[model samples]
Every structure is written in C-alpha cells, then in structure tokens.
Target: MIEATNLAYRIEKDSMGERQIPETAYYGIQTLRATENFPISGIKPLPTYIDACVLIKKATAIANSELGCIPQEIANAIVQAADEVLAGALRDQFVVDIYQAGAGTSHHMNVNEVLANRALEIIGDSKGNYQKISPNDHVNYGQSTNDVIPTAIRIGGLLAIGKTLNPALASAIATLTTKADEFQDIIKSGRTHLQDAVPVRLGDTFGAWAQILSEHQQRIQTAATDLTKLGLGGSAAGTGMNTHPQYRQRVAEILAQLINQPLQPAPNMMAAMQSMAPFVNVSSAIRNLAQDCVKISHDLRLMDSGPKTGFKEIQLPPVQPGSSIMPGKYNPVMAEMTSMVCFQVMGYDSAIALAAQAGQLELNVMMPLIAYNLIHSIEILGNTLSALTRQCILGITANSDRCLAYAEGSLALVTALNPHIGYLNAANVAKESLATGKSLRQIVLEQQLMSEEQLAKVLDLEKMSTVNG
Candidate 1:
C-alpha cells in the first residue's frame, strides 16, 4: 500500500491497486482516481445535482433502516451526513468532472464515499474505517449506479426547470404581454418574405412572441411530468435483484414527500432502466423553446437595427458600448446574448438526442453527459430569458413617428383601396408610386382616383391595422 506522512495520507485499496488518499478528504481513492482520469471539463456537476444525490442517499438510509437492512445507528449517521451535504457542506469533496464515466459510476462512488466518510466522522470513527460504515454496504445499501444516477438526473432536471426556468419564462411572457398592450396604438407595416405586405399594430408582434413563449412553457411542463416516474429501485439492469419488493414504493413515496412533487415508481422498471426517452422528451422541449428564442431575438435585432438608415422601428435598451471605434453606437446586447444562449441550448439538444439513442440492450451508459447537458441547458436558458425580459423587452421604446411614416409610405397600402377603386387601379397606383419615388397616399390623391375624404376613410391607418376592421 502507498503511504505518506507530511500531508497525512491514508492507504486505500481497490481491485486494480492501492493508492494514497488525502487524510482530510471526505472522498476516498475512487474519487481521487476519477479526478485524475477525467480532467476534461473543469466544470463539475451542478450543485442541484449533488443535492439530489444526497437526497437519494438520505431516502435510501431511511428506507433501509425501516426494513432492518442496516443497524439503526449506522443509518442514523448516514442520514445526518446526508443532511449536512444537503445543507451545502463539503461540496469540494465532489470533484469529478461532468464528462466522466458514461454510466456515472465515478460520480456514484464519489457520493457514496463522501457520505460514508462523513458518517464515520459523525459517529466518532475515523474516515476510511469501512469496517464501521462501508460506502457500498451501508451508504449505497440497496442501490446501483444504474438506478441511482438516472434517478438523480431526473430529480435535478425537474428541480432546475421548475424552480428556475419555468418562472423565468413566465416572467418573460408577462413582460412581452405588457409591452404588447403598451404598443397597441402604434401602427406599422408588416412584412412577409421581408417585403412589405400589410399594415399591423406593433403590439401584435409582441403579443405573438408572448403566445409562443406561453406555449413553450406548457410543453416543458408537460414533458417534465414524465420525469416524475422514476427507476430508483431497479438495481443493476432493472431486475430489482438485491432490493426488497416494497423498497421501490417506499422510496418513491419518501422522495415525493421530501421533494414536494408527486413522484411515483415506473410502471415498467425494466423499460425505465433501459430507456432514456424521458430525457429526450425534455431535451426536445428545451430545443423548441430555444428555437423560439432565436426567432424572437433576430426579430428584435432587425427592429432595432439602426438609428439612421435601417428599420429603426424600436430602440433596445443600451447595456454597453457596441463598438470600440464607432463613437455613439449601442447594440442590442441582450438580444444578441439571448441568441447565443439559444444556439448553445440547441446544440445540447442534439447531444442529448444522440446520447439517448445510444443505449443498448438493458442500460444506457451515457447518463453522465446527458445529465450535464440537460442541467446546463436549463440554467443557461433560464438566465437568458430573465436577462432578455428585464434588460431589453421591458425597457424597449417604440419609434411611433417612424412606424407611422413607414406605414404611410409602404406601396402595399394601395391594397386598402382595392374595394373602393378596384384591384386594377390599386395595382397601377402601387406601381406608379414605386417608379416615381412618391408615397402611395400622395400618388392616390394626386391622381384624384377618389375624393380626399373617401381616400382618408379607405386608408385609415388605425382601421387597417385592426383585426377584422
């Protein structure tokens, strides 16, 4: 066995070999080796994920204790240690990278070892004294990496979406709806294929955006319900081999109570254990939401394109300087940021989709990457929605004069006189206006196709913009 003295090391052995572990570390040799092996991403699993694992340990400890599977004292110690972890203690002990082993065995062992050592310390025993409390036999009593890791992923994903993303999206929809109401009186020319087609209220554009986000929120919530069905007691490959039959139901009930969400055991444990479809569904919903955000951000950028030569229909709140050399330039920074975040989330969706389909026979060995990407997507989207809502959507100011001018000048406005002067005359009016560099209104009045009062009634901006007017 390897040994050290100046830093106070402990000898920990595995089937592969023995190694020196730091005496002060709650994590043992497995975690230390994982840290060395998977030095890929500096990012660790999200804190919500760590908390979910700790909750699983606590629930298992209580369930095992109730079934007399372990000594009451050991179970009590495990529970206390898990509680400490939930309270955010010893977070540094979980040092494995998010890109580690596909089955998440490294992360599973990290949780087991940290809780085992901490329980030993709580019971007045030294760390690594597994004879008193073993990581496998005690802390991870009836669970397998297969069941625990997937269960923890669902738990963490649900929690992040519920507590972070859903609220942020709701706030964004509300902000958009508010802006929609504020801009109802502002008339503008609407474009189809980027060509002027008809008159539309600027408010209608914001209303459409709000409706899109509302639909996405509903889709995400519906998909999240699928996550409530868990595979926790399907030890190993869904055989439920080492677990009591009642263990699954008890654990589900306990977790539901603890998390305040109605969680239930999967109807088919084998299917649940073998499939990653639930994760795929959630990822698809997130991707759909991201796509909507991209469309919205691009529209905002176009609307706020320029103050001198572009559409300039609206002005975005200036968060920072847009250029180093351009003196008085401010960009739509928030919208641009939202677009980048959506693109990243879309990339995550592709990764999750591929990982979900990569499963073979009885288990998917890609849980670690799936979990990492799902959590990251949720967090980034939530932050993006919040930033877009507060910094851009809420602070936007409509350029009413510019909007009215564009509406009045658009050649497509000739369509409003189709019934009064007939389509042939209306087409000629539009063509002459474009060719002569004159406004549609000016051309119609100069041609005396209709009296000024009749033309005014036909080309009423507010009436043309209203639905079914």
Candidate 2:
C-alpha cells in the first residue's frame, strides 16, 4: 500500500495487494501500479487510440448484455460511460504511460478501470466499488489485453487514415495539381547530374510531384484495407476462452456499426493475435510515402534555394524571418519542416517493423511500441503535409524571368541542334560556347553548320520547353 503525502485517498485491492488510489481518480489499483512501474516516456495513450479501446468496450458491453453474459442494467451504465468518454469526458483518467507492461495490459486495465468506476457513478455507487460493476468481471469480461491491444491498433490505424492522413494527402495533391496548371507556361532549365541538360516546363515538375503523391495515396489506402480484419474475440491466447459462443461475431458486428466501417473478425483468431504483419504493411506504405516526400521537399528547397547565389527559380512564401543574424532572409522553412517530419515518420516505420517481427510464439509483447509508433507516424505525416500545402505549396510563385534566362543560356540548347548539325558537330559547338563564352547559336553560325533560319527554328527556347513542341 502507498499514500500521497497530502491528498484524499481511497483503498483498492488487486491480486498482489492493496493500494491507496486518489479518491478523485476513476482508475483503480491496477492502473495506479502501472503508473508507478513505468515512468518511461511521459507520453499517454493517443486520443484516437483511447477512442478505439472505448469503442471496443462499448461494443462488448452491448454484445455481452444481448447474449445474457452480463445484466442489461450494468451494460447500460458501461455503455453510457463509454458514450461520455467518446464525447470527450474523463480523458485525463487514462494515466498509464505508453510504454507500460507487455502486450499493453497496463493501458488496457487503465481503460477498463476508468470506465468501470465511471459506470459505478452513473449507477449511484462510488468509485473503486468493483464488486457492483467490476472492471474485469463486467467491463472487460470477454476481452484480454492480447486480443484487445491488437484490435485497438487496427481500429486506431483505420481511424487515423480515414480522419487524418487521407484527407491531408488529397488536399496536398489538389494543391500541387493546381500549381502544376498555374506554372505550365513557364520554361526552366532541366539539369542532369547537376549540370544543365535541356529545357523543361516548370509546370511539368509540379505535375509530376502531384502524380507521385497521388500514387502514394493509392498505396496507403490499399495498405489500410488490411486493418479492417480484427481479432477482437480471441480472448487470452486466441482460444475464445470465457466468452459466449456468439460473442466474437456479435461484438465485431456491433463495433462495425459503431465505427461505421466494415470491420470483420479474423478468419483465424490465433493468427490475428499472433502476427503483426498487417501493421508492418501499413507502416511500410507510410515509409514509402515518406521517402518520396523527402525527395519532393529536397527538390523544393533546391528550386527555391537562392535569390542571389542559388537556383531561385521559384519563391516559397516567406512565413517568417529565416535568421536573427541576417535581415530580409526568407528560407524554405516549410519544405525543410516537411523533410524533418518525413524523416521522423521513416524512423517510426523502422521501429514498428522491428516490433512487428519481435512477436514470440503467441503474443507480441512489443505492441505498445508498434501501436504508438504506427499511429503517431500517420498523424504527424498528415499534419505536416497539410501545413506544407496551406503554407508553402499554395503560396509558391514562379520566377518567370529567371527560368527563361536559365533556359535561354543553357548549353543544352545544343541538344535540339543535334538532329540538324549531327551529334559530333553539336558537341563541338557546345564545347566552343563553354570555352569562348559565345552563345550556342553564335557558335553554330560561326561553324556554318546550318542556315540562320534553320538555327533559329531548331534552337527556339520556347519551342524546346513546351511538351512535344
């Protein structure tokens, strides 16, 4: 037993012993012990994840009541408590650290205890009176941490993708597509190996980014489809022990109705509880998207590099002063931030992958890590993309004069002349232009490789930059 030096307390007992829980707290002894045991990361369970667990409890309460596993009045109180939590009450009651106990038993108990205590209140009883509305006997009657945690992960992933990531991606793709159309007429120098090679439309660059993001969006959606398969009814070791015969299908059906998604029970309960492959698939998809986002962000930074000494072909909107030391310095801060967030998402993916493969014979003890990392990755990536779209992508402006200058001055213009003057002759002209500082047209005319009108027609920058021009 333990006591705070200066607070009102109530005594609660568990298998090991008894402890003094805060009188005002909805969580019971099990949760109090977990908070003491794991002071690891101060991070709490995510709200979306909390919602997932609460939704599960609500569905189970309904199922258990319907199947005569529990009294309907107790089920009503439990469901009422779940509704209150879903509507944003008792959020602070979930006090366990995200890194607690193998298989997230600590966090699971935290949820059960909170709802149980709250339900007690709704039924004219005080908190910690589990005898009347037991957290284990009623709230979590047909569930175990093994089954609950995995199902929570699936539900949380689906919710995050639907409510956050997908919408953000769609907005970003739309913004990039609009930019692509807006900049299509502007011609810029295209480079290979950091050296000028040919002319390209600035719009095509943005259009390609839009296409890449759209493709990634498709991949992520495809990956999320696997999350709909759940293992909710696989109580403790996947045997459906202590649960009603109809509990599995009934609870899944109720949860599907509550979440408004087509959630179905896994065909093999044990396999669903044992393997973390579905999470790995979604994490891998997010990682793939992050990799491409990093590339795109780098491209943006390079294109917006300098007003005096860099590409400066496009100007990212200046959201803030770039440096304290230098005035009038506006950096590509949004793109820079996008890259940083993407790198973090990639790191989370790695952690999730390791945790996914670390499962033992029956249950993976690393679920806490996987749950936190995967869902956090999705949420952060979505937020970063939304900010980038609104603050950077939408406000971008083209430097038409600079783009034209780069295009007109590039020695790659000789590329078009290759057909007219032969490859060797064109190479010689390019070499002369670089060495003598003469224009490609001037060098070509000096060599008399083609008529002036022919050179004019062949070496047109506007024609060369436009598609199929």
Predicted structure with the largest lDDT when compared to the true one: 2
lDDT of 2 at 75: 100
Model 1 alpha-carbon drift over 4 Å, by segment? 1-6, 445-451
Model 2's TM-score against the true structure: 0.97
* Worst 10 contiguous positions by lDDT, candidate 1: 1-10
lDDT of 2 at 171: 97
Clashes of each: 0, 0
All candidates: TM-score: 0.96, 0.97
List per-prediction Cα lDDT, in the order shown.
0.90, 0.93
Q: What would the TM-score be for candidate 1 when compared with the true structure? A: 0.96
Q: Write the per-residue lDDT of candidate 2 for residues 91-181, one digit (tens) a residue.
A: 9889888987889999999999999999999999999998999999999998899999999999999999989999999999999999999
lDDT string, candidate 1, 26-78, tens digits: 89888888988888868887898998899999999999889888899999999
